[model samples]
Target: MIESISKASAVSGTKATESFSSLFEAPAATLEGTGATALNGETFMSALGNVAMQAANNLKRGEEVSFDGLTGKANTREVVDAVMQAEQSLQTAIAFRDKIVNAYLEITKMQI
Candidate 1:
């Protein structure tokens, strides 16, 4: 009886292993369909232009508030808010630029 049980257990283990192996094997047709989109220069430049425009807008608003005065023309809080927004926008733009430069340098160092 012990021998019979051992044989049954081995058969079940073999079946389980076969099923697990099939789970990872991709169909040939599925593999053929998988592809990657390539990034190009236009997309990169457009994204950079967007960030610069946003930063410029923020600074322009801050300047407008400062020039118009905080009396009745503009609320004291509005001027302060504009200035803070401009500062944050500029800082974010600078950080993003640094990150992109670092990535470019790292990629250039990689082997083909």
Candidate 2:
């Protein structure tokens, strides 16, 4: 999967770079006192939700493709690719969940 992703980025070249930069481009606004920029609550939550949904969709697609392969609808390569991608996504989601849980625990241990 990493090889495929690298090949894809290589194929896209400058277009991929432009898209990546544009996607993460900073907003213009800054906080009143801190002068630091941050995503507003709604925007942050929406982005997080979108990521979660995408992962879920990927996992579902992988399952569907596996079933299709069993039914002779999808080929071996397609099923393998989908399954690998889904596994990667699941690992990422698990890592994120672990980080969040650890952060919460740390916060609880902090002195107010």
Candidate 3:
């Protein structure tokens, strides 16, 4: 029974990761008028903005779901999913920040 439960949980986790990934795939219709029809057409600044917005939204969702869970309005699975997504977003943002800081330091060390 325990093995079956663990397997089921693993499958669900895989599905959640897939769904999360799909959220970042902008539909062609939405990109049509923005001049970013292709993935490469997106500018760095716009991509950064989109990532920031997504992170903010994920954290917000986690908070909301947590509150709902406390009030008995949300199920455990939903709360867990939201929190996991928010944590992933935060870690990604932190990683981005670290890379930017390292790049700045590297630039500072370069000779004029």
The root-mean-square deviation over C-alpha atoms between each candidate and the true structure, in angstroms, is 25.2, 13.0, 15.8
TM-score of each: 0.56, 0.66, 0.64
Residues 1-112 of candidate 3: C-alpha lDDT, one tens digit per residue: 1233224334434767467446566767777878866666664545766787677778888989999999999999999999999899989988997997898799899999
What is the per-residue lDDT of model 1 for residues 1-112, given as tens digits with 9 covering 90 to 100?
2233224334435767567445545555555588633244233444555677777778777878877764469888888999899889879978997997898799899999
Global lDDT of model 2: 0.71
Report clash pairs, candidate 2.
none
Candidate lDDT scores, in order, read: 0.67, 0.71, 0.75
Model 2 agreement with the true structure over 44-90: per-residue lDDT tens digits: 43465566667777888898999999999999999999999999988
Which pairs in model 1 have colliding backbones?
none
In every candidate, how many clashes are there?
A: 0, 0, 0
TM-score of predicted structure 3: 0.64
Supply candidate 2's per-residue lDDT for 58. 84
